[model samples]
Structures are given as C-alpha cells and as structure tokens.
Target: MRRRDFLATCTAAAGAAALAVVRAGQCAQGATSEVAKYAAWRRFADTPFGRVAYVEQGTGPAALFLHGFPLNGFHWRGSLERLAPHRRCIAPDFMGLGYTEVPDQQDLSPQAQADMLVALLDRLQVSSVDLVANDSGGTIAQLFVARHPARVRTMLLTNCDVHENCPPPQMRNSINAAKAGTYDQKMQRHLDDPVYARSEKGIFGSAYMTPANVADAAIEYYFNPLVASPRRKAQLNRYLAELESNPLLAIEPALRRLKTPTRMLWGTADPLFPITWANWLDQALPGSRGVRRVEGGKLFWPEELPEVVADEARALWRV
Candidate 1:
C-alpha cells in the first residue's frame, strides 16, 4: 500500500474512534442529568401517613405513577419526562421506601399503602387520576381501585401481584428473612457492594433486563435511604413481611365488579410475576381493554423502556 493511502486510512480510523468516544460520553452525561433532575423535582406532601415525598411535573388532568418494590418515584422518571406534556405527572415514594417519612408506629401493609395514596391525592386536591403501576405498586393499585372505584379515571397495570399471588413463590426466601429480622442485613450488603447489587443474587438481576448496565448512582439513590438507619431498616423489613398476607383474594369480587377502564401491560420474561397473571387480570376486570405483551421485558421494564409505558398510557388515556 502507498504511504499516503496508509496515512489517510489511519487518520480516518482515529477520527471514527474519537467520535464514538464522544457519543458514549454524551449518553452518560444525559443519564446523569436525568438523575439530577429527579433529585431537584423531589417535593413532600403532608399526609396522615407521613410527609409523602413525590415528584410532580406538567399541568393538566392528574396522572399517578406507582413504582415497584425497593423502588421509588424515580422508577417513573423516564415516563414522567415523556408524558409530562400530556398530563400532570405525580409519582410518590410509598411508606417504608425511598424518602417517605413515616411515624414510628406507621403500618406498612399493602392496605395502608393504598390508604396513604388516598391521603396523598386528597392532600393534593386531586379527586381522580389516571393510575399507572408496576410490581407491588400494582397490588396497591388494585386495592385502591376496589376501595375507591370512583377515584381512578383509568388504570394501566404492568407485571405485578394478582389475586392470591401476592408475594409469589420466589420471594418466600426474602419474606422469611424479613420475618427472621435478617432481610435488612441483606439490604445492607447490597448497599455496601454495587457489583453485588447488580449481580444475580440482587434486585437488579432479578428485576431488570440489563443488570450490569444499571448505574451505580441509581443503586445508591435507591438503597441508601432504605438502609440509612436502624429504624429505616426495620421499616424496610416490615414492608416485606406485610406482603405475606393475601389482600387481593378478598378484593377479587370487587375487582370483577369494577367498571373503570383498565389496561394490562405484561413483561413476558418476568419470572416473579408471569404473563399468566396479566391474563388473569384481563379476564377478571370487567372493564379491561386487553393485555399488551412486552416480549423479553423483565419486571422493571417500565423504567428501562419508558417509551413503551408512555405509548400504552397515551392509548389508554385516549390522549
């Protein structure tokens, strides 16, 4: 090869490599900016349960987003950014999770979580909301719909507990640890080790699509407050232990009788809550529009694929 041709090819390769590096840096910067934005958006609403921490954006009819276990309002950060232009987006950290402050004797049962949501909406003067939820939040969403059928304008449910499958078989070990008062210790280990937090033994591996790709900053943001102190650790355990009871069984009748328009978005790959449960929800709810299968999506797909959440939500809300 000619010397001039060799030089030209080498220069071109270096330029391409440099451009790739710049693009990668830009993506990382964008994610960091999003995390910072969520931190800045945090606000607290005084409810009977506690000073409920939440993030709100946009201006229009209200839309409530409920997160999964061990996750807070930040779970819906991507969806919130996308849907803010269409409706008022509110995502609150439930008691025993995230930044919500609860009284020393506060109940962390699913029922209490549902009631806390009521208190929160009332505090915000939001009479009704387009509800969106995932994991344990979906369980609370059902209870909320059963108790206050008139309050939910429309519901969009992702992979979550349905009927008798409250805690699921896979979570039995964690619940047992909670019952034995060792679950909090396990959480502490996760907090101390980011690599483990994203490993097969931790939440990221079990719930997320790309466990290793999860940001360290996000892991800290989630687990830090949960294991912040002794009281916080106890509260975290209580939250898990409370899930042992089958609250959905009793609400089955009410769920069937419910007339609120609903949509189910299921992640087919989620082992904890299978697509079968989503189909069950579709069959049970009288007003169910149908189930939309998210192929290969795991339990926390809404966080990973916010465009899917926003698209389905817009279709359900008819906006």
Candidate 2:
C-alpha cells in the first residue's frame, strides 16, 4: 500500500480505538487521550490585537503553524503533537478566530493577520521560524513572508489561496453567505442537524475526504468560536470580505522575488485550491522547494494527515 493509504488505515484504526475509549469513559484522564492532550498544551498570550491562544509543544527550532479560516490552532494539534519531538510546534489562533479575543473594530484582512503573527512571534521572543500554513493560513503565510522575508527561515504551504483566486469559486458560497451577514442562521442550521454536519456535504465533509474520521469534539473546536457572539460573527464576515479583495496583487512582485526556501505539500482533491494553484505557487515564490502531492487529500489535510505534514516540514528544514 502507498504510504498515505497505510497512514490513513492506521488513523482509522486509531479512531476506532479512541471511540472505544470514549465508550468506556476512560479517556478523561490519560495523557494518550485525544481530549486530554488537546486540553493540556493550550496557553494564552497577550498581543497588541488582543489575547491570542496557542497550542505549543516540544522545544528546539520553531515551526510556527498558521491555520485557515473558521479553524484555529486546534487544526494543527495533531501535527504539533506528532512533530513535537523534533521541533517546537507553535500553533496560534489568528486574531478574531479560535480562542483569540475578537476586537469590536478588528481588522482581519490577510495583511493585518500576517502583521499580528509577526508581532505575536516577537512577543514570544522567537526571532525566526519555519512556517507551516494551510487554507487561509496559507494566504497569511505568503503575505507574511513577502512583508517580512527575513523572519522566516523556510516555509511549507499546503492547499490555500493565491493571487486572484483569493477565496476561489468553490468557497464562494460560504463566503457570500458570510458577507451577506447570515453566519448565525447558517451556523445554527448545522448545529440543528448533526447528521448533515457530519455528512460529506457539510463544512467538515466538504474539506475532508472522510468526515466521519474527525471527532465531534474537533468539529466543535472549529465552529464554536465563530458563533461565540454577534461581534465575532461580524469579524467572520469581515474576514470573508477581505477574501474578495485582490489583496495578493499588491505583494505579487515581492513574492516573485522571495528566496526563502519554500515547499509545497498540496492536497490533490481540494476543490478550492486545485492542483493548478500548487503550480502557480511553485513558480510565483522563487524560493520554491518543489511540490508534494497527497493523494485523496482534501482541504483539511493537516487534521487528517498530521504525520505526512510533519515529514514534509522535516524534509524541508532537515529537522
């Protein structure tokens, strides 16, 4: 069997084991329990924007992870745990997302998000880092590298937005819904129907090849923060609006000039960021390390293929 296929099988087996543990109510205290593990490594940092929550583990060279929209640092928890032995994995919830505090007048545009990431790193006393970004986090990472190339030692990008594709057509429906100010109504619709929420047609389903493979608790971690309040909902809308703007056009020239040793770990099945975007990124970012494809991988590959993600980062940085 292919490596990813073998890994996927292993994950399925582990999920079954975890479910058995959950049934026995034995997952509440063990360090090996997914629930306990996710709860343990969390911390809050006071940044200029607000309080940012991050899941940090291991210690050595820093591998800062940036997650896409509607998801937060929790998205990288699996990879962080897997890679903790070799690298310090720091996954922070971007401003107004995850457990981070949302300001009433927050500016969550990609550029602002990138700036906040830089500042957060500064406050943490991390002078340099290797970036691992996916989804909207990929957009933010690119912008971060373009604006502050020196701070990044290397970068690994999974499927994400680039250039005019911004939000991409497949993702437009959700973005339009958010922009139309219908976040609450739509979110409630999912909350009301657990079956649909777990179906392939649901939020998690649309991104993951096997939605059932993801735990309900993990799904909650992605959606609960967005529906925390109307103000937070507005922040979500603001972030969607930024997607429509041609934000990357301004930085294209700088990106083409970048030489930061970039690597691509693309999910072949992602509708939003098709394989073509991987080619676009490989060429656009002159620091291109090359592209690595994950067969049957979808948008939320980090959540599903943590070990592969870690291997790619290790390959690029020689960690």
Candidate 3:
C-alpha cells in the first residue's frame, strides 16, 4: 500500500484501458475496409461460354448489376452490398471482363455479351431480373431489354452508351488502339501509376468525381484478372474491336419500343455521357421512369453514391 507502488499500478491500468480503446477503433474501421468488402460476396458459375465470376448477396427479387468497360463486378460491389439486404443483388463479370474466362473463338460483341448475361442468369436459375447497369453495361442492358423484355422486371441505367454513341468520343482512342494491337501497352502506362490511373482523363478518371476516394483494391480487382495473362488482353481486344456502333445501333428501334419500366441515374458532369444523353434516354424509351440527375456525379456514381442508387432502386421496386 506504499504511495509509489499504488501510483505505478494506477498508471499501468490507464495504459491498458487506452490500448483496448485503440484496438476497438481499429476493429470497427477494419470491418468496412476494401478487403472486407471484397471478401463478403464471391461466387463462380459455369455457363456455356466459360466460368463466370460474380458477387451475390441477399435473397429476394433479383437485381442484376452490369458493369461498364474496363471494369468488372467489383464496380458494383458497394451498391450490391447496399441493396443485398432488400433484394438479391447479383453482379457478374462478363466473358471478357473481371474474373470470367474468355472463349477462344468468340467475338465478345455486344450481342454476344447479351447472350452471355442471359446464360449467366439461366445458370443461376434467375428467371427475371431488375437490371441495374452503368457505362458500357448500359449498352448491353439495352440489347437484353430490347431482345428479351419478358425476362427483365425493371431497369436502372446510369451514365452509359446509347444508340450510336457507344464508347463516346473520349473512349475511342483506347478502342482504336486495341484494334491496332497496342491497347495493352496503352493501359500499362496508367496501371503503373495509381495517381495517373484515376486522373480526369485516365482509366477511371471520368468515372469518379473524387479519384482519391477510390480504393486500391477496387482498381486491382478490375485490372488483376485482365492483366494476369496475354489471352485476357486478346479477349479485351476482341471486345473493343467488336464495338463498331453496330450492335447497339441495330437495337435502337427495339429500345424505343421497350416497355420494361426504366430509370436513369445520370452523372450530369460526366464528359463522356453528359446530361444530353440522359435526356435522350428519357425521350427514347417509352417505359422510362425519367431521368434523375446527380449534379456533380461522374461516370462512377454507383461507386461514389451507392446509397442514392440503392434508394432509387428500392423506390422502383416498391412501385
């Protein structure tokens, strides 16, 4: 009970309590980290084309997420997780994207992508889906909606390709380079530098308003699979080469006639798919629920604004 002994014991107790508090904070933050999110939902299915990698969560009316070009199901990771509790959220990596295997002799055209998506849904026994799409996935979603309206319950199309504006002008250089067999080299430059990769005109630049907010894991999730092999590079090349404005162009008439209730969440500031395109979508499709413009939204609003996307989807389904 000496004074020095009691003081020493008190200091030790205080230090231990502080350590516990620090550890607790770390655990709380860790729960929402990129690794935790990526680990949450991962599955693969064998389709006719190849093995398709997807992330699925929850169990209710199916909400299938389709990602744009140069990205994969991971692009839908945040929104998928948010919507999972309410609906069955399925985000699949297409044949030439994400963790999916590419067919050797296949062209991977937009129609081919449409068929592949259907096959994916069939393999999973998904009869009908509330389709949610962004970027180039919007183009393929249009094809699917136009070609097989019966299987689609409703649709949410964010910033993406419509009509002959597939790839838009900003994205043409990469596609043209891919045709000339130099895409891999071009992409490598951005892949090498994380900062440059997310810049305004970079790979994911136009996608996000605040590029620094993007997780390194999200970027790697899209790049690692495609960059792992030369075959994947070729597959990506075939995907780009097939984008001649024909596939989506051919489906324009069907799109105008599409009756599946459609909603568009547009990023108004997106240089590639501006608000004008959103207006076009609203006017073109008779079934459109109309456009909801995000004032500072970019191409990657799903990543940047998952809650808004989830809220909009919930509203659509409630109707």
Candidate 4:
C-alpha cells in the first residue's frame, strides 16, 4: 500500500476509535466482595457446536447470559450475583472470543450465534430460559429469540449493535477500520490514551465493583481475542458484510413476532450505540416494553443496576 493511502486509512480508524469512546471513568482501588463472589463452572464442555466454558452458580429457573464483543461472559460477573440466588444462572463466553473456541466450521452471523446459544441451552438441558445480553450480545440474543420464540421467556438488552434500522456511516467506517491490518497496534494505541480510556467508563467499569479489577484484569481476559488481529480482521469483515447483506432481515422481520417479554436496558452515557438506538429499537418492536432509561448509566447496566436486573428477572420468571 502507498504510504499516503496507509496513513489515510489509519487516520479514519483513529477517528472512529476516538468516537467509540466518550470518556472512560477512573477505576477503583480495592478488591470488593463483588469480585470474590465470582466462581466458575470450569470446562463443562457440552455444547451443540463445541466445548464451552460457562460460569454456573445458584439454582432455580435458568437464566442464560450472552457476552458482548471484545469481552466474554466475564463482563457479566455482577449480573451473576444479582440473578443467581433467585434463579439458576449460566453465562457463556461466545465462540472465538471467550472460553469457547470457534468451532471447526461455524458461521459468525447472528443466526449462527443464535444456534450456538440454543445449543448451549440444550446441552445443559435448558429448554427455555430468560436472557440478558449487553452490547453485541444483545444482537445475538435478539436473533436467538426470533428463531425460537418459545425458547426465550424474557430478554434484557444493553446497547447492542442492531443494524436493521441502518446504523450510521461512522459505524460502518469503524467496522472497516477494525477489519484493516494493524488492528493490534491501533487498538493498543486507543486503549492507552487517557481520553480513550476515559470514554466508556460504563463499559469496563460495569463489570467490576472496583476500578483496580478493571485495570489489572489480564489482557487475555480483556483483550486476547482482539489481539488476534487476524480474527479481528475476519470478524470485522464478516460483521460489515452482515450489515451490508441486509443480514438482519431475518431477525428484524421476526422482532414483532417475538413473544418473549422484552426489556431493553440502556446506559445513558454510551457513545458507540448511543441512546438514540434505543428509540429505534423501541419503535421496531411493536409491543416491546420500551427501553428502560438509566439516568447516568453507560452500556453495562447489568453491573450498574444489578438489583434492577434481579428484580426484573424475578418478575419475569415468577421466582
């Protein structure tokens, strides 16, 4: 590539990355009990597609969690504590990114993601359960519910990348940027910037009750998947293609057909998905309970509003 062309591409990516974060907040200094309450189900290995690692604890009716992009179910640590005691909880790291490895041959589209999630439920003998999804997980959960309406009893969504309504030109630009080479270097450059780090305080901070956990968490847990620049390239390419292919046609058409009670949770401070997307989602789902507003919340409310999540889960499941 010509030097000028490469520089232009990098400039676009930097601009997209800058907009992606509004400002991250200062993380905390100590290990809170919220961090210790965490426990893992180990390598439980029974999935429709591949062996998956899930964090399972407490017992009652089942509640399944799907993690967002760039992070796995580990992001839902606080959500587990809130929902578990009232009901059985299982949150899995989505394939190619978390504890779950990408299957030998699996499609990365939303439909395929939905199938993988249902397979996880079936292997665990979970016929139907409540679903909570944040960020990209929200997109996956929506696809899953559309495919098998009876399988999802309820859904709580955070700001996810839903494109049925035609996302902004910048979103597409960002996807293109992520698909380009030098992703690792580009992503690191952004992560270390104070302004970059300052933005999305809600995204990383929601998972931890304290700031230290957010800071010191292993790069493997926080960034390994993205560090796989090739995979990052593939994912971004697939994602953009999915966006262009009218990929959400299946899911979008099925939203109104969804019988599962839906509650979209939004972080008021999020910049990437933004509060406006919430309005778009509400209008798309004719009967959806509308996006529940969070005053100062960013994208990860399951951490910021664990009690609210627990309350809604109980009401939805009658636990």
| lDDT, each prediction | 0.91, 0.82, 0.82, 0.64
Which of the predicted structures, 1 or 4, would earn the higher TM-score when compared with the native?
1
Clashing pairs in 1: none
Error of 1 at 202 (Å): 1.8
Q: Is candidate 1 or candidate 2 better by TM-score?
A: 1
Question: What TM-score would every model get versus the actual structure?
Answer: 0.92, 0.88, 0.87, 0.74
Clashes of each: 0, 0, 1, 7
- Which residue runs does candidate 4 get wrong by more than 4 Å? 1-40, 103-105, 163-168, 187-213, 218-220, 225-246
For residues 121-207, what per-residue lDDT tens digits would candidate 3 score against the true structure?
Answer: 999899999999998899889889888999999999999987767768876777788888677665566667767887866767757
Give the candidates in order of lDDT, highest first: 1, 2, 3, 4
Give the per-residue lDDT digits (tens) of candidate 1, residues 2-49: 999999999999999999989767766776777788989999999888
Query: Per-residue CA lDDT of candidate 2, range 44-96, in tens?
Result: 88888888888889998888999987788878877887789988889998886
Task: Tell me the tens digit of each residue's lDDT in model 4 across 131-156.
Answer: 88877677777777777888877887
Lowest summed lDDT across 10 adjacent residues in model 4 is found at 24-33
Looking at candidate 2, what is the lDDT of residue 226?
78
Look at candidate 3 and give me any clashing residue pairs. 207-300
- Leading candidate by lDDT: 1
Better of 2 and 4 by lDDT: 2
